[model samples]
Every structure is written in C-alpha cells, then in structure tokens.
Target: MASTEFDFIIVGGGLSGLVLATRLTEDPDIKVLVIEAGNDLTSDPRVNVPAMWPQLQGTTSDWSFKTVPQKGMGGRMLEVPQGRMLGGSAALNGLNFVVSSKDNIDAWGADLGNGPGWNWEGLSKAFRKAYSLTTSGNIEKEGPVQVTIPEEDTKWPQVWRETFAGLEYDPTGNDDPFSGKNLGAVMRTRSFAGNAYFAQARSRSNLTLWTTTVVEKLVLEPSSTRVTATGVQYTKDSSETKTVNAGREVILTAGTFGSPKLLELSGIGEADLLKSLNIEPVIDNPHVGENLQNHPVCVLSFETDPANEEGFETLDKLTRQDPATLAAAMDAYSQKQRGPLSKTNCNAMAHVPLPGISTEEGKADLARLLNSTSTAAEKGKTPSAFAKKHEAFVHSILTNPRKASDGPDGRFAPPPSVSGDSGGHFTIGVMLSHPLSRGSCHLANTRGELAIDPNHLGHSLDVEILARHVQFLESVLVKSEPLASHIKTKRCAPRPEMGISDANEAKRFVRETAIGASHYTGTCSMMPRELGGVVDPALRVYGCGNLRVCDASIIPLMPRGNPMATVYGVAERAAEIIIAGL
Candidate 1:
C-alpha cells in the first residue's frame, strides 16, 4: 500500500469535490488529493453523452442504494443511484442547467440566513463563473461544461411555446432563467457538469485524482476544543489499504449519504444511536443523519398525436419492437452523433403556485391540515421521541422557507424515463420541490451501505400538494387546445385501474406512485444545532475543526427546482470561502 500526504484531502470526486479541487489547485502552491470510491469516467461515453443518462443508473457507475421500505411510498424500497466515480453524478445527472428561481436562491439569506454570499447575487456570479453558454454543435473550443439551448429547429419547441401561451402562462422568451426569472415556461439548458469543472484541471501537477479508493474512516484527534480531523483511512483497488495525512484540512464532498455515513463511522453522530450500535462517540451530534430531504415526483403520462424527434415512438417503441430499427439508430448515432437516441423529451417545463393550480376548497383544506399539525403540542400529547427532536424541522418546513420560490412549492418538468422505453407515452412530472416530509441516513457497520429512510411523503402535506398538482395537470393537459391537440387523455400511475377520484383516493394514488427526484439534501444540514443542523452557516461541521463539507449534504433545503444548479453555485461560494482562509 502506498501512502502519500497532501495539504488537502477531499473525499468523493463527485460534482462538489471536483469543483472544489479544481478551484483550490488554481493556487498551484497548494497540493490537493481527491479520493473517489468509483473509477474515473474520463473515457466512458455513457457518462459523456447527455441522452445516455437514463441508462447509467444501477450500472457500475452508480452506487445503487435502496431505501428502507417507505410508508409514504406504499412500503416500497425505492432505488437511490448515486454516482460512484470521478466527475460523479454530475456526469450521470439529468442534464438541466437550470439555476433555480430568484426567490428560491434568495432564501439562502432571506429565510435561513445562510449569509449574504449564499444569496442569489453571490450564487449568480458563481453560476456565470462556472460556465460559458453555447448553441452551436461544438465541443473542442467551448466550455468544459456547455449549457446549451439548441436553436429552434424542432417542432415541439414552437408547439410548447404556443401551448403555454394558450394556457395564458407567459413564455419567458430567451431571457435565460438562470439570470433570476422564476416564473414562465422555459426550455432547458443542458451541461455535463463533471467535464465542465474538472477536465481543465486534469493536467495540473499539484492535483492527484485517485479513483476506486474507498474512505473507510476519518482520522481525528481530540483537541482542547473541537475534534480535529487529521487525515483518513482508505483502501485503493480493494485489499490495499492506505493511510494519508492532510496537513491543511480534510474536506468532505462525498455528497449526502456519503458525508453522513463517514461522520457516523468516525463517531460523530447521535450518541444514543452510536451506543446502540456499539460505536464509541467523540461527539453526540443528534443532527448528523437527520433532516434527509428529496423531491417526490409524480409522473404524468400522455400519448402524443404527432411526436417530436426525441419522442417515445421514435426512441423507446422503435428499439423495443424491431431489432433492425435499433441497429439503424446505433449506426446514425455513431456516424454523426445524430439520432432519436441523441436527445430526450424533457426539454420544456413550468412551475405553478398552489392557489393558481388548486381549487379554493382544496387549498383551504391543505392550509387547515398544515396549521392543525403545526399547532403547539398539546399538554398531554406525548409525541414520539423522534417527533420531539424534530419539532424545529416541522415548523421550519411549514414556511417552505428555503424553497420560497414564488409558487406554492410545486414544480412540473419532463423526465426521459417515463417517456416510455417500449411504447406510446411521453411523461411529465409534478414534483413537490419543498416537501415537509423528513427522513434519515444511518449506518450499521463501516462496510454496510447507508441505511436510508427517505420516508418519502411521510408528511401528509406533500400528499396534498402532489394530489393538487396532478389534478391541475389532469384538468389542463388534454382538455385544453395546443397541448390538447397533441396529448391523449391518459394516466400512467394513477390510471383508471388505480380508482383515483376523490381527494382521499388521489392522496392514496400519490402514496403508491410518487418516486424520488434523487435530489437528496439536508443530512448534514446547515441550520442551527437545535434545528438539527450538522454544519454551521460556514459549512463547517459543528465540532470538527479543520474539517468542512462542500457538498449537497449541507443544503438546508432543496431548491424549488433541480438541485444540480444550486450545488454548482454553492460549490463556487465554498471555494471562495476556503481560499480566503488560505
């Protein structure tokens, strides 16, 4: 086993880890070492091509985690496929380069008071600093991460514009929502985050990118104050275990599940759980594995009368029904990188407020339900011990604060998966972006994977929001013109077989159908300690000196859109903070 020391050691070479390493190495005087559990994806086409994103999950590239059976999702064990490689999930992610909403971004300061730097102005600059926009089909000279909004050559783009107009929702024409525009039906901007952030840094001699290295535990020593993270114990290529020391600092960018699991293994979690599991504790931090959050999305299905180029009929059905057709598509893709396989159907989307979409009575009922549960504990309530511990979590989410985007915390976007890999359906999703439900990520042993309890839809408030969103979509999608002329009136999950009619039935339908958006955040949250925050506003773990987390795990709340853009902006801010100290 070879042991090498560095000024800085970053665990997990995913989106945040790569971004931080690239930024830190800019100094050249400082050396950075990155340890990734998965192999480098430098030459993998599945990790590069945006259209192949759906096929990546559960493959060697993904740490295909399965959550404990969730009551909210009808006792189903949903898959949690996190990236395990260099460049990480950033390479395998749904390729939307959306920067979230203005109000949503502002909430980092306005609601949670995460500080001025986390606000939209600061994050917006970071977003700009991270990418160069592109449209032309060029890769060699453009950004390492190219956020592209292709030219209006496709028929679906115009159809979507007219359809949104027909619905009277303003289409924010070419304004680039990344600039702060939150409302409006906007087309997506795509990027491969891993390449955009890490490719250029590959040649830097000061940076050592180590792949297939699993961090076994964090090496820490008790100081007069906080426990100092000295270095780490890791193994490369399975059997060859090695120990490396960090002279300056140890940063945890291993993402939500990884960061928390590492913390638990290193004896920095709730003392009770630690004791129960026979692990000694250095810190009895009750918040380490709590406040796990995700966007529970409900997929809505439709049959397109005249399909787009990347529609299901040309992609899924062709490949499924005929081998010759699949061969032809492969040939076309290989020849010019142009074919139905080169794109996906989820290029356009919309966000709506609860009142704007739901019936007045339904809205009233939702408010009443939230208020009832949100009321002060009764004198004799005797709630569950966990509920008592997370009272702050419940109160904080009632405001849906960090997700304080203009809407009623609802987002609808297209995902390629439901667009049918074998038939005549194109699917869109209605996601409760700021769900009130909470879960946890714990560890049994160092070798066992994280015991995840995403507890999806555990809170009834999310069910109301999802049901209303679906009801609104059902009312508008096929009944109206433009989109009406295109989509056939049908349901996929909440189909006629599901018997979904009343509010209760709809809620039940949601329980059985909702799937994760995979945007996990808040395990090592950045709120006050009482509110179950694992890290301080500065992204430092509460009692770990010289140790900080610069990943999605520190996000107190999931943004009102996909969390990827927000992750990039946050990482940029983190780099700035880390550099200032140096």
Candidate 2:
C-alpha cells in the first residue's frame, strides 16, 4: 500500500463527516481527507427528488442491515436501512429538519458533564453556523449549507396547519423549544435548491472526498498506549486493499454502526467480545459497542380518495377520475424537479408531553426502570402508570375541538375518525425520543463484515412508553370530537391476533412491531473514560492521542427530534475544536 499522510483523516463522508472536513479545511494550511464507503451521489436523481426517497430502499445506496432475532419482536428480524453514500444517510433520508428540545440539551449537559457549551444556546449557534437558511423574513441564512421549504404545496401542508391550530398550537420559529402545548405547523426545512437535492454547498476546495473506500481498521502503535491512527486500511471498488494515513489525527466519522465495528476490529471493545473474535485486545473497554440507541417509529397510512393524486382507485373512481392526471404530474416532476416529487408527503409533525409526562418525570422513570429492584412488578408498575397518564392527556387533547383545528385548506381535521372520508387520511405514529434499552455493535467474524445488534424493544420500559403512545392515538380516535368521524377502529395484528385489549396487549404490540427511525447513536459515546465512555467530551477517544470521533455516534443520548440538524451542528462545532487544538 502507498503511504500518504495528512493533518486529519476523517472516515465516512456523510453529513457529519463532510461538515467536519469542510469546516476544518477552511484553514487552507491544514490537510483533511474524508474516506466514504459509498459512491458520490452529487447527481443521483433518486436522492435529489424529495418524494422519490421511499424507492431508495433495498437499493445499493443503503447498508440494509437486519437486526438479530428480537426476543421482544416474536423472534423476527427487522430491516434497518442506513445510507452508504458520500452524504451518508442524509443523502437517502426522508429529509425532515427538526431540532431537539431545549430540555434535551440540558439533559445532555447534566448527564454527560460536557458543560453549558454543549447546551441549547451553544448548539443553536452551531446550528446557525452550519446551515444557510433559504427562507426569507426572520429566518435568515446562518451557515454553509442551504435550507428551504418545499415548493409543492400539497394538501398535507394545509392539513398540518389546521390540525395544530385546532389544537391551539402556534407555529413559532424553527429553533423554538418544544413545550407540551402550542404545537403548530411544522416548517419544512430540507437540503434542496429550487426542486433538487442540495449537495454543492458542502463541496469545498481543500476537502478531499474519497468515495467507495471502506475503512478496515484503525492501525495503532506498538505500545498501544499512544494511537497514531497511522492510516486507514480500506477496500476500494470492493476489489483492492490499500492503506492511507493521517499525519496528525484520525477522526472516526464512520457513523454509529460503522464506527463501533471499526473500533472492535482494532481491538478496542469489550475484552470478552474481542477475545471471541480471536483479536488481540488494545483496550478492555466494555462500553465501546454498548449503549446503542435509536428512535423507533410506527407508521400510519390511509387510503384517501384521489383529489390530489390517483394510484389506488376503485372501479367506480377509475371510471370517473382522470387517470392521466397523476401520470402527467409524475412526468413533469421527473423532467423539471417540480410537481409531486418536490413534496415530502409529510408536511408537519406534533410534539406532545403526553399529559403528566415531563422531562424530569421521564428521566426519573428511566433511571428507576434501568436500576429497579423489583424486576417484573416494578417494570409493570412504572410504565403502566406512565402510559395511563399519557393516554389520558392524549385523549383530552384530541377530543377537545380546540385541538382539531388546522390552518386554511383543512390542514388539520379531527384525527381521521372525526374528519370522516372527506378525501382525507391520517397516520398516528409514536416515536420514543429517548429509550432506556441499549445494544451493541461488534465484529461477527474477522473478515471485516460488521454485525449490529440494537437489541430493540429489549427494555420493558421502552415497551411500556411506546404502548402508551399507541393507546393515546387510539383514545384520540375514539374520544376526540374532530377525530371520531374518521376512526376506523380495526385493531391490527399482534394486538388483535393475541387478543390484547388491556395495557398488557398494548405493550405486546409495541414490543413486536416498533421499528427504528434509523437515528442510531451512542456506540462510540463521548464522556469521561471513568464513566465507561470511549471518547472524551472533546470527542477524542481516550488513551488515543491525535484520534477523535466526530459524528452522531459520539452523542450520548438520542435527542427528542430528527438528528440531522444536530449532527451537522456537532460537526461544525467539532471542526472548531480540532482547529483550536491545532
């Protein structure tokens, strides 16, 4: 292998990695190299078009990981698709832009001891510094990356505005901290220019982005005490093996799954797990692959009569409605980056406190569940209480007519059931913002292939919380005046097949079907090494000087919303840290 060195070696060219590399390279004196395992997607049409994302699944651009048989999922393996392109998962993601709660930032400071610098104010500044807002009035450009609202004004946007207004919620600025009330129209923010995906802003003069380069392992010094990172050994075009070096530092931005697996292969995980793989141990840290977390989501899809588009139609509607209309719309979008392809399909999202559930309550409940004395009974009690309270709050919120109003164009209808079939649709998805259950990533064999065992639905508390979320949705459909007309009370599988009607049944349903939102985090966590953390608060892997990790993997906990903004912010902040240290 030819040996070439640089000031910094960043593995993974995803959003986070690119941000770090681009920001660092702004100082022309420093050399930065970014190695990506996937191909360059600068002009990939599927990635550029907003609505074409769903079609990206099962494609080569996705890592397409399958979780090990989940005990909580009736021993079923679930498909977990992660982006493997230059922009990383962001290139293939749904392109939702939402920031975390202020409380979430405070919790991170309190839990990880990263100081107030990592708080909301600090993170917000970083967010502004990383993204360039394209919207006019109040929302000004803040960073290098451009952001804009979708051009296609679909019915979903109006629906979201009306629904939030009915709920007495107000649409505030994009960075406003979320409280239980005042839920409003979710402003659409994405990496788009006019109608196409935006990737040009991140391409910098000094940043060297290497595509289709998979990092094999982190080479260490003989002492194993001082890790030079040396260079990354990788497979190019999936045919040849080569090694490239970092003259000063190696930053692991290979994302959650890829980062931890690289660490393990380099003998930096739990001593026992490494021994199992017949690799010599460099560090006996048990937490390297531990504490894996993700946001689990359950989708709701409805069959709406086509006033907007017509893919599915009854014989009667087909005879009456214009079939050529939708085809023409699709064709138009494909050619000009306008029309339906510009729409994200999801216009808005609501964040509720679920009644008596507050940030403090969740923290305490999580601690007790994680370290409870009574296993079965205590597990049953806390979550049950939490669920009941949450469901009650949801019921009250939805049933109240004030909570069902939307902006103009019927954006918000009473939770589907109440809206009846006015050519409308509803989907009540419950997402666990922060989960207590954690899993790990390690080497399955020595051949370099990785294994990700998230152990999703492993925690009884997670099941309890998710179950309550579902029950709350059900209560809204049944009790809310606005939602009653649209309520299709057909209980689906796992819940109905098992004949589960009570709290237990709801919990079982959550356990069996809750899927990851693909927000995988905390594998190579950042904290003081004494607390079982791999990287320090500065994101440098402890005991390994000149080595750092700049990605979501370093985030100790999953925030309360989409992580894209946060990931970009972290990378921006990290570049400053690395530069200052230099």
lDDT of 1 by residue, 364-441 (tens): 665687676542442321124434434344334443422221222211222344533344544567777567677889
Q: Compared with the true structure, what per-residue lDDT tens digits does model 2 show for residues 171-280? A: 44343222222222213223622122124334555567678778888887747346556877888777677788888889888888888888888888778888988989
Candidate 1 yields a Cα-based lDDT of 0.69
- Overall lDDT per candidate, in order of appearance: 0.69, 0.62
Candidate 2 overall lDDT versus native: 0.62
Among these predictions, the greatest lDDT belongs to 1
- Where in model 1 is the C-alpha error above 4 Å? 135-144, 150-154, 181-191, 306-314, 318-321, 355-366, 373-423, 492-494, 499-501
TM-score of 2: 0.80
Cα TM-score per model: 0.87, 0.80
What local lDDT score does residue 97 receive in model 1, on the 0 to 100 scale?
Answer: 57
